[model samples]
Target: MLVWERPEPRNRPVPAPLSRDRIVRAAIRLADADGLDAVSLRKVATALDVRPMRLYGYIDSKEELLDLMVDAAYAEILPVGDDWREVLRSLAESVRHTAHEHEWLADLLGGRPQLGPHALASGERVMAALGELGVDAVMPVTAAVNAYVIGAVRREIAERRAERTTGMDEKRWQASLGPYLRRTIATGRFPALATVVRDAAHLDADDTFRIGLDFLLDGIGARVSK
Candidate 1:
């Protein structure tokens, strides 16, 4: 199912009738149906009812197709406010939304960023927004924010997939762990764990994401001010 180890997209000397957009779209559909791992030139060709080698006329490799797919996903993300902080937050949330919609996007995002036109434009927009904050080292600041957002989205997606596969919500999982947790608490062995469970309200994904975003933005602000 892994595309990386699969055969290369058959190369062709002459231009095939298939357009790059059509191939990328087909690959995206394949990913949607069976995940990014299931996407391959061979499979995409089958989906398009063309020979695997024919796809090479448009796409060089699965890696390029994946990069295109990532950019295509990026193309769907909307740009936000002109303010630096607001822009960063909006962009991150937009990416998170896209990843949530296409689970395969999360996997591809963790790989190299596609410097394709749409992806580069997104980066440029983020950097331009940071200009509002008088950030001289725009590239580094943007990279840091990008890294933070990517890491956050990746964790979010993986955890969501885990929950789906297990068919258990957080409440159910916590309830199942209740006995063991209570037993540990009863022994008074871990005061911190006991105190947290007693005092802390459970945070859902959105709440946790907001809290984490605020914390990260606080740090970024401090850096910007310095």
Candidate 2:
């Protein structure tokens, strides 16, 4: 004899209504508070007071949520003045500021291809600015600017994270390593680096970023003028 029985339906909690925008915002908040690794679907669902399954309707995976978050961040960056140099400078500064505010952004930026609407709009604005300047190779120029900004911001974020983890600022960290550095410099085999280690002025991260950006832009200007 065989017995057939229908299993009882399990009770599941009803999830609150959630939109994509709300989901993305919640994820951003999580990331802002506790770095990118903290932004998981389950965490975001908990923040939104919804079941994790409900988030699946709005966001497919962590990567998709990150893409949406990146787009949302880009949307915060409004267009500046029309002058090409000013526009580019303003864009770089804005991105740097945004990266500082959202430290996780430095991790994702330039790490993947961003084709979201807001990301595309940002690229369009930069391209238009270069076009206004009669840049013959707009893509290369835009890429160069993006490369500089992304690299600079990534370095800034890395140093910040390192300091936070080590409980020491750059100066203190250097001082801690002073004995080893001094011994290595005394070997007289690396004169140029020794000179820099001994004589280089200590610029804070922000100043270093701006100075490097200005130097890059100066080279671009020289090329354009020629």
lDDT of each: 0.80, 0.81
For model 1, how does the per-residue alpha-carbon lDDT over 108-184 read when each residue is reduced to its tens digit?
A: 77576467778778887887888866666677766776687778888888877778899877788888998998998
**Model 2 lDDT on a 0 to 1 scale:** 0.81
Model 1: what TM-score? 0.86
Minimum summed lDDT over a 10-residue window in model 2 is located at 1-10
Cα deviation of 136, candidate 1, in Å: 3.9
* Highest TM-score model number: 2
lDDT of 1: 0.80
